[model samples]
Target chain A: MNAPVPGTPEHFIANAKDRVFFAFDRSDLDESAVKTLMGQTAWLKTYPNTKVTVEGHADERGTREYNLALGERRANAVKQFLKAQGIADARVKVISYGKERPAVIGSNEYAWAQNRRAVTVVAK
Target chain B: MIKVLSRAWGRLGAALFAVALGVAGFSGAARAELRIDITRGNVDPIPIAIPAFGGGDEQSSRVGADLAGVLQADLERSGLFRGIDPRAFIQSFASMQVQPRFPDWQAINAQGLVQGRAEVQADGRLRVEFRLWDVFSTQQLKAQAYVTEPGNWRRIAHIIADAVYERLTGESGYFDTRIVYIAENGPATKRIKRLAIMDQDGANHRFLTDGADLVLTPRFSPSLQEITYMSYYNGVPRVYLYNIDSGKRERLGDFPGMTFAPRFSPDGNRVIMSMARGGSSDIYTMDLRTLERRRLTNTPAIDTSPSYSPDSQRIAFNSDRGGNQQLYVMNADGSGVRRISHGAGLYATPVWSPRGDYIAFTKIAQGRFFIGVMKPDGTGERLLSDGYLVEGPTWAPNGRVLMYFRQTPSDSRGRGGDSYLYSIDLTGYNERRVVTPVQASDPAWSPLIP
Candidate 1:
């Protein structure tokens, strides 16, 4: 895996600021999503010293605690994929946001689709 | 012979119904006497009237009505008051705010009266001022004012209910407390468990974590703010303490094993938990202040679900050391271990009642789950109710009632199982279901607010 240079457009595009989403109530990654995540994995491998945090989130349709666990599963799913793409496991930290911070406000399915997501942020 | 048997069964059913009615009447009188001991004058949930707060325009009148509706619901749910209908008001707030017509309220058998005024301030904040009066005594009980966003009107109503509950019960109220539980979604085989917190009345619901790892058995601190729970984070089951006010958490210990069923001490200075090092689990206590860990029980058998007495002088827990699981009590420092329960069942989750009078426990007998209570000495054992799977008894602040979870069996398809929170009086009369958005379990009640 070739490491992308920091401060490059590729780096910004591959980082967490772009954000990633999941299917409804699912933590598995599809082939296209996996391929896109691999590009970010290459960038993370290039910057060995930089740490990243994965925040898991869920839609507002379920109970608060179960959504928390679902958020955690989503974040862990992303973390596992990143590890498989040549990024060291130690660099990834996961947290479950549950349904607390929803990206959309409505109670409909469209809003929930946006809420069910995980975002990678620079930890250090 | 079959006809004779049918006649005997019919007689038995009629006899049971008569006995039930007689028992109900007797228990009703007993409850009235008990209330006199706990609260003077039979308290009978003082009848009070809340008039629409004056000074609101047509639009603000609607808001006031909404606010009053919320307050009425809160007070009624506490089982502590009868809110008089506003339509029965003979005097308007404009004429009563300065000096209420005591005789008018007295005629309606109202013992207390609440009058208030609401206004939308220039800055868009809602300002509300209210006064509570003892109608019979013609004395003022409480007077206060608050300012908050319009969206927080429900919280303001709860604050008022708390004040009213405190003044009447002579004990702090639980209206301000929050409940943390496992929120469940999806099918039984692949259920997602998340950590969620909400007000006692099921408002302001928020999730603390995503369903990435399994979490269970959340216990609140004495302050009713912090939470300690068992989580399988990092692929290891361990105890973790979280600050509810601030989103910060720390792993409890670095033991090379699994930890589960963590609870805070009465004084909030230590955490008592069950740690499984090998195949056996023992009870351990860790001082949150000193970070010093001590083993409370060193047995080779399972000793789990440890709860500290209110005074922190004794601990009640469940152990299978003596064959089947039974209730046991020990000194706080781990001495004087003694078995308390001699019932005909396996008892798990022995929770010490907050009033220091009884121990609430979950019993598995005859392939059914039952919640029961007994004296600290293990006598006067009484089972409250039976269910398919009922566990985790948490005490109401006054210790007069208990709340627990009941999980119903799934259908033939095995895909529609559900669990809910339920509360029952200690005497086991008022059994009611608490409403939640989804499946809730492992409820822990907080102390009454001061």
Candidate 2:
């Protein structure tokens, strides 16, 4: 298949920076995550046919299993916010990678803060 | 079972070995005792000499050397005995079976001596005979024989070391045990983790699960042949039961919500786990035989990481019901709830020790993590080890040692981040890193195998 053209609405939805971040061990979206999610919702509405997968993640801190549940809560929170902003529930899927997947690769707070995130990826 | 050293002196102790000499027909008494009188809680390791075994054929000779090496490593790692350099040994292996030249050992300042002989029988079984001697007392303290299949040479070595430790310190040995942990690979963002098991000393290492999906927090059952851990097999995190012998996997619960942080009951017949639903987690127990689920704790906060006492009478766990993360204790039925930890930091993973005297916990404060233990009522809390990231403390079967994991910081580029498992004595001394083939975390030590 031919590669999709860059800078399309779908492309913006799939961008890594389109992710909504949360504080440590929390699922509620902060002001920064809310601003990012607004931009994502605007682009997502431009392409009505676009389906997105909301993937939730956690920083490597607490117990492994609890982190997983926390990740799910983050993803669900993101999904609920997106749907309330006019994204259809049918077009959104949610999954949690837990602490298994981090956006940054360090043990410090900076890395952990960056890792606690949820990204809306355009489904292929 | 033999006590040769008097406790009143408190400076030295004896090393005794009780073996199945009846099968080997070695002629002397089945038990031999020697007195050295070393104290139990010495920081400095007692200098000891262990010569290679004699009278083994080519194959047995190789096995014998490996056995001796493993024994030496076990003793040294315990922080109780230091093996002297073989190059300084004046008595040959052949001379060790007979009366050792006490003068030669004394010249090197050796406090104790261990000598053994190995032979492969006509039936293809290997027989190992060992003797412990007190160099200062110039007396043979203990001698015994072990007969087992050739493939089990390492276990035999561990058994020997345990006997020596028990005889000397008047305490049970923890050498003949296994540890299960999460082995990690890949970069920090997308780390791959698999359940791995190995001998206490990192020998016979093997992965129990392929890293197809993420697995973590593996805990051995009271019986050594099975384990309980959390896995995301189908993209839904849940607790699973894995049989070590048959390689079978079974899901513990089909709860609509996530079930994680599972540990076997002290009786090994039920599993105590935390089930998360509706933005809250609660501790629950499920009978293995009947699949009956019992809710032990029902609070709004994240009440997880439940561990049972040795007698299964009380449960110790971590919860946020007290406003912040702290340790709490309640009856097995979730009654008589009381807070145990009032420390300055957030406490997670409160494991009731197997000996029922203390509760091990991980404390996070001021961006640093600490492994500490306290009494059941939360008094006398002493932090054992502190680091950039240290957590997941599990007690050894004997409850004299605690093992946990520590993670070092990685640079902004995500370079140099590594995690290692460590063990420390209950007194907060003799901390040793448990070496694994790769980065490891969440260590769970098994009870001594039957």
Candidate 3:
């Protein structure tokens, strides 16, 4: 498979690979999550017509309702940080699945570390 | 509540039995007394015998056996009474109008005996008359009757069980109530959940909502007709009130951001919920009549899961403003904020017991979940039950037992796992699984049905 052309939608989406991670019961972005968000902002700026939904999630460590609120804060944190970095707020839609949707599904710390993340999905 | 009325003959027989037992002096009064001390919720259940009822036609006789079975189950489930195996009975209950052979019951060590008669009246209504007896003293403890349509036999059984339970334990019975919880299906990633309700004994299970959108955190109103819950119906999480009888749905308010973790006020007049705005969540209360919204917690941290005290004067909730999730208490008007949980673990979902003696909560410590209770002032914390995932502690109407959900871990792919509801005594002695039709979570016990 040939590499997609630079600055194409495919290229920008490929650059938006890494998802942000959060500590337990926290929605604030850590240094690593902030760095990942900073990298995504570059690709978000290149594709002006690109719209994305910030899907927020939590580990299966807390109550469902509180995890939902935490997910919302995480998603909004990503959206706001992107908006602050010159991305359009309208282009960044946010939805919190709480701990309802997990990227990894186990009860261990490793699974939880992967599950507690915010992923930026490119809207069709 | 129907007051027990002992007929003249029953009263005379009880008096005679009391006099007969009086020969032993000290053992006389205590043995004749029907009440059982349930303070520690006696793990060794009292042995009781409930023989099949008599005086019914063919169909009525079948129902009589069923009624006795249900009564037996209710008493057994309370963890206060154990129904002795009928095969050990030396004397069968051939007629309710006649007294039981006390020597025969004593031979089997049966402390209590319940006998009843069922008859079809001229109007086709079933008339149920039952008598509870202290077997050792042969004293009639309670005698009550009910007349209802034959089709409503289970309710009659429950009513009889309640009477028997009240007479024996001196506490109100919880067998007549219902439990509302989330019935979950599909997989962990794309799970479908519906609001489901069932009888307290896991009978007559029915779904209240279709699994079209995600729903969570169901709570019963002080009145059992309506339910307040959080639903993501329109792609936005918000508090919704569902009328079970009318099949009507109404959004509590048009909040700009997500609203969740809803609970009805003790008086069922207002709803307290948590709403997220500007990257933070806070607690708020909205009156159902005027739709007037009042902000309860102004914290930048997540403050959710607000529960009103039985008196409706104070509120107990969980907040993370203290750097991690911990329980807090505040006035109903959100005044005099103070932290109640100074424990080592994260505390969440603090539900005030109906009796107002203790506050139940979910705690996470050292990679496990625990359902625990503490006084309102946060001292005397006791972890009732713990597991891989046990949460959402809801008190029975009498506040003597707590029901919560437990989940076992699935495989790495999140398949082959199961969740169930469990109930534990307030004194943390008896813990048993509450059967659900499907995987269940977030149970809310209804107040006793009128």
Candidate 4:
């Protein structure tokens, strides 16, 4: 591996917010999510070789099988946003962890608010 | 992925036998003296006296006591019978062999009396016989004799309990069944879930798979020792079929994208599951023998958790085609689809009862999850219980009860998250927590063992 550079994935993650949150059972990206994706859009356009993967997640309020689909919708919602912002389709992929993997461990609203999210991962 | 772990995995191979003892002219018109109307919501537990089965020697006597104890436990656990204290018994097991002194049982308020005997055969096998008598009527209601391997006493005990239960209540018993479920442990963020199976009474607990990868939603075949479940092995979700007896397992199919929430058809000839492609998912079925796949539902919305009716004629699944997740029913050939759940909330996991009368499902309303049942045409919907996150209702083989997993919410730091298996009567009366070695979820009860 080469030395750290300004256009590296680490730099892209540090400068641009790589994640967005969603409300309960909702897939539509809010204004804040758009702002986060706009930040990532600029970084992805600059780093032509960098391919990002959008990972969607859900809260534990739903069944395991349904949450998987919900997570996919959330991830695709991010992918659609990036495509609208001039990010090519080939540079971005998507996956969903559903409720199987949660960002926060608590069962409260504060934790769920963070758990229901989509993250743009800079693929190595 | 055909990993064979030796073939011909089986049970007590033709050696076990159960014959009705003294069944000549057993009165079929006799009324139940200690009757339980299971059709109703709740009933008082019947008091029954189970004296130890008489045996000739010490070892046989020990086995006899164990058999009687297990039989009593199974009946008591059903919430239908109360075992009288043996210390208050006025008659001995030997005396009960000839006939039970009706007054002695009536003195203890016992409406029923169960007496049996155990003897070690010359070939080292065991012979266990049981007789169920109505204390007030002074007549033998049921009697059966089982001869099997010496170590197969527990199963025989369950069978005897089933016979007695059927004799008392007009319905078949679920004592001889097994429950396959996901045994969850570890932290909230990274839970280790392993496939585990156990007897109905929490005996014979064992894990079927190591927790190397994430596993979920284990469902047993209606007629075999096989189970279909999903696993995220190598970071790709695939449905797998595992045999409990042989310990051999294989990937069910190689679909395009993630294949999950797999359940066998009622006859165990095929598997129905959800395969996700892009942002949405759809239901698909794969023949177990040919590996031929058939798409059941074609929609952009999520269509998953497909379960078949007992007759395999209709499928009741959960779909979001109508904007929100609710129950849907379709013909076996994927024709005539209609929404079955008109409730204002989301419904998932629609498991049809073995008796083909009602469909059990998990519903999310307001901010709570509930275990509920509904008829095939979506009528008579009833919520059995609701909680913070109660889901996955599986019907017992007899279809008179349901077992599901209930999880209590954790604290802010995820300290007190507790999950337990619970069984509730179909009439919504007896709700009892099933004992498990670890935190459990996604319980699927096996059909009554042949």
Report, for every candidate in turn, its global Cα lDDT versus the true structure: 0.72, 0.81, 0.84, 0.87
The DockQ value obtained for model 3 is 0.65
Q: At residue A62, what lDDT does model 1 achieve?
A: 41
Ranking by lDDT: 4, 3, 2, 1
Candidate 3 CAPRI assessment class: medium
Taking every candidate in turn, the Cα RMSD to the unseen true structure, in Å, is: 16.9, 6.7, 6.2, 4.2
lDDT at position B14, candidate 2: 21
Superposed model 4: Cα runs more than 4 Å off: A1-9, A83-91, B1-14, B24-32, B95-97
Q: After superposition, how far is residue B428 of candidate 3 from its true place, in Å?
A: 0.9
Quote each prediction's TM-score.
0.67, 0.87, 0.92, 0.94
Error of 2 at B231 (Å): 1.2
Pairs that collide, model 3: none
Task: List, residue by residue over B1-450, the lDDT tens digit for candidate 4.
Answer: 122211232453435677667743224535446667889767889999998877888988999999889999999988899999999999886733476777888898898888899998887889888888888767787887877777778788888898888989889999988889999999888989999998889988999889998889999986657989988787777889888778898888778677888999988899999887767889999998898999988998999999999999999999989888999999988899999999879999999999999999999999999999999999999999999999999998889999999999988778867889999999987899999999999899988877
TM-score of 1: 0.67
Better candidate number, 2 or 3, judged by DockQ: 3
Model 1 chain A, poorest ten-residue lDDT window?
Answer: A60-69
- In order of DockQ, best first, we have 4, 3, 2, 1
TM-score of 2: 0.87
Give a tens-digit lDDT track for model 3, residues B304-403: 8999999999999999898889999999999998999998989999999999999999999998899999999999999999998899999998889999
